[model samples]
Target chain A: MMHSRAPVNAVIMPRMTEAVVDVRELRKTFRVSEREEGLGATLRSFVSRHRKDVNAVAGITFRIEAGEVVGFLGPNGAGKTTTLKMLSGLLHPTAGEARVLEYVPWRRENAYLKSMTLLMGNRTQLVWDIPAADSFRVLQEIYRIPEEQFRATVKELTELLELGELVHKPVRNLSLGERMKVEFAAGLIHSPRVAFLDEPTIGLDISMQSRIRRFVAEYNRRNGATILLTSHYMDDVVALCKRVIVIHRGRLLYDGPLADLAERMAPYKIITATLHDGAASSADLDAYGTVVSREEGRVTIRVDRHVAPERTARLVNDLGDRLADISVEDPPIEEVIDRVFTSEQTTVSA
Target chain B: MIRIYRALLVAQIQAASQYRVQSILWMLFAVIRPVIFLAAWVAVARSQGGQIGAYDVRDFAAYYICLSLVINLVTSWNAYEFEFEVRMGRFSPKLLRPLHPIHYSVVENVVWKLTTIIPLGIILVFLALTFDARFRTTPAHILLFVPSVVLAAALSFLSSWVLATLAFWTTRVHAITTLWDRAGFIFAGQIAPLALLPGPLQAISLALPFGYVLGVPAEILRGGVSVSTALVLMGGQVFWVVVFYVALQRVWSVGVRQYSAVGA
Candidate 1:
């Protein structure tokens, strides 16, 4: 749940002192010029620019407490990355207030900077021509990490990520997954207190993504650091975060536990049944419910959550001789999210 | 801060080493420019009865060799790097660090020049020996040249950084930097001796910081300036140092704000 802080003496008293990240009405807007696609129109635009303001992040408020791993969910162009940039001090918000560890992020005070890190997938901060270890050393110096602590952190991260010899190779020579691992190590050389990860596993293989997810979870458990992660992959969120904040078109759509979101948006279950001896075709099961798929002898159907049990019982009795096995389960998270977005579209159009 | 700088410098040098072929090619470019100028000036001196503007053929050789060294020590390509970084969205990662991004440029420039200086020095010596060029450096002149070269490098880097900040506003930064480089070369005595220029042009060179970058250092090494003149020239270099420092700060602050607003 989100809470509103009192307005009195807000400057002297930071809102949500207990929260590691406190954001209120955070907003960012860009004034982009509209230019026609022609040489003459381009020249005309130079003389008379037509600028339109696009709000990348509207007034959205949320707080993340210490040690909490919060998932930031949004589609492309939904302001997720913009919000992360603001929280990490890369971009100052056009309006609204944000405090990380009780310091205004835009101020970027040394203590604040030393206590946090931002990692963006598909972008690298490492020196591409040198080994990642060398960049790690640079970070150690820049963050003033104590030698013993730096060594220990390096060892721990290396072990966790199984980064054997990957740190020794030049970043340009490393594969995407290897590079991402090194990036994580580089960003964590100082063991920052808060990590803002934007699409950190975007291009990694499934196994590599799972490894990173496990490492993140372990890091949070061991250090109790706060984390804010944004990813298009639902598995990343489902595995690493219990709570998720869904945003669309720079607006907050929902904020709660992941399971609650699925329940609220998708009130249905999938019924997968196996035909004995492959006796029945997939078309024969359409009378039961919406047929999702029929592969081999198994058929999957979607049924209303409230009537799923009754429907399964009727199917079992009706197909007693033909059915081999049946199971009922919640719909996949992707489908739930699709429903959420579809519902939001309906509300917008309405 | 010192430790951080050392680490950054080491990393940059390692990066340069990784691209050694490119570094050597860049050094060759630097060497060729001065050699070309030396050949033209030597021809002109021989045509004019072995002397032109107080420099004989051998003296011209020495002047150009020393000019090449000074240019190598002071020149920085940070403007180009900054333009590329801004265009490619590389500045976003740099902005997240606690250290100011300018330090990265500074370290890269210093390390790159340091790594390239050995090859440049060998070329200078080869030209000096081949052309029978002589330098008139005393211990005092040498001492003055040290500070002069250091200040020139700082001025060059700061000025380049200031120009690089233009990338925050427009994509045509390359043209602006090219114009600045032309001004630097023409006025900084890369083409000819500062004293050989017309009176008004020499005055402009003396008044501007560009001449102090290469021409003054070359003059000091060539025993052209008296002790008093050397000190005055060094003072002028320090003045520009302060001016460029302030300009860098102003430009970086404004530029970063603009960059953040524009998301580049």
Candidate 2:
């Protein structure tokens, strides 16, 4: 669907005219080059270098209203992280415009900077030698957080992130997950209005991942902090974001509700049958739709939602004695995504 | 900003504390490099009957002893570290703060040098006793020395701001910083007093800001300063500050533009 701003501008009044984050037709290009090997080519390349321009992010624009939690989704090298950096004012864009809280992001004004935070996974933002709490004290000084507000935010985040005991331990001694939790707490001490998370759960165990995911969700719910979260982990996107923007090859491939994209990818059903007497030499379920997998006593196949009943009935009639059990379900989200990525110009659901 | 400076210094202390052995070893290396120079220069002076350019072996010992102490105190390698940070993408966090990253760097450099000061002072005391070094000073010069030392440190830091931003457009800033670093030693009079250099070399020394930062204040601390010499030196100090201050504006803008263009 077309992402238009005319309606968004018309509906809002003249007085309450603040968006926490906004972007339009943003682009970033890199002058990357072919790697020359050996002394000969390297010497020759210096005289007249061969260069290729990589469009890291090409004309993808979307706005996050105040307190909106939007998931940025794409495969590897899809420019989600690049886009986040541009919005956070770490990098400037080659074309188009972006604004955060009514200030130009690239200008990186102190006031605009004070109102935002950016967190990247696998990066150390805390002082590594000191106790996590002491690093927080350093942040308190840097951000000029008033004692009262600093204490309240620290206490709230510590409790929510379960950092009570971990706070006292040196950052070097803490586990990766523990350090990440403290990092988040330190980031929020200033009470920034916007937060950018780049792969926040890239290398955490299942339990730790949930702890971080829960902390992120709870923090947003309580504080109404506008968040743009980028994670390859589909679970993070599914659990936290109602709306997701997907980019492929630096282009906006999808931008809408998560459920809508999933619905569009896999609009049919897959049925798995367990048989008692079906000892066929081979399995050929393609007449119905497509066979996904087959075993000795079980076979799974996908069928159009409207034709599922007919397909199920035929399977039962053909192997009534062997039909021990049968089940029907929608395709997995991963599979739907795989199909979307594999084919283009298919009958995508609106 | 002062409050932030204090905390940044304390935080760097805590961070460096993790590598306690490395710090001690570095201190040891610091001692060896200067003492070796002191011994060699002193030997050369004594061979010439205890005199080289108005400095006897004792004077040489004292000059280098003080040089060793102050060089470590004012020199900041944070610019090279900043270059690394930009290349590795760690600069994003620094830029996200409400204050310019340079403020943090400036604070940390001051703090880091001060933290190392105690250990360095101990070495200085040992050298003074070993070499019969003299550190005579008047209260007036002592008062002036404080601001001079602070200005020297600021000048040293601001010059690096340009070096650090070189990473925005090119690789090998570490090499570039090292090249300039050696320039500081040769021209800033870190190795020899500006007066001892040949006329042309002395001209080169005075023309560059490095001498104002390291050599000039250093001479001031040695306590034979006339009022005019002190004024001229401090005036030269202010000139360097204004020069580097303007350089930072150009460097920062281009650096940020380069960063965005590359989508870093």
* lDDT string, candidate 1, B92-115, tens digits: 777777888888988887887888
Clashing pairs in 2: A92-B260, A276-A322, A277-A322
lDDT of 2 by residue, A113-134 (tens): 8888888887877776789888
Residue-wise lDDT of candidate 1 within A107-216, one digit each (tens)?
Answer: 77888889999988878889999999999999999899999999999999999999999999999999999999999999888899999998999989999999999999
TM-scores for every predicted model: 0.92, 0.89
Which candidate should be chosen as best, given TM-score against the real structure?
1
Alpha-carbon runs more than 4 Å astray in model 1: A1-17, A277-289, A294-297, B261-264
> Over 4 Å off in model 2, which ranges?
A1-19, A274-286, A309-327, A344-350, B134-136, B260-264
Candidate 1 residue A154 C-alpha distance from true site, Å: 1.4
Q: Docking category for candidate 2?
A: medium
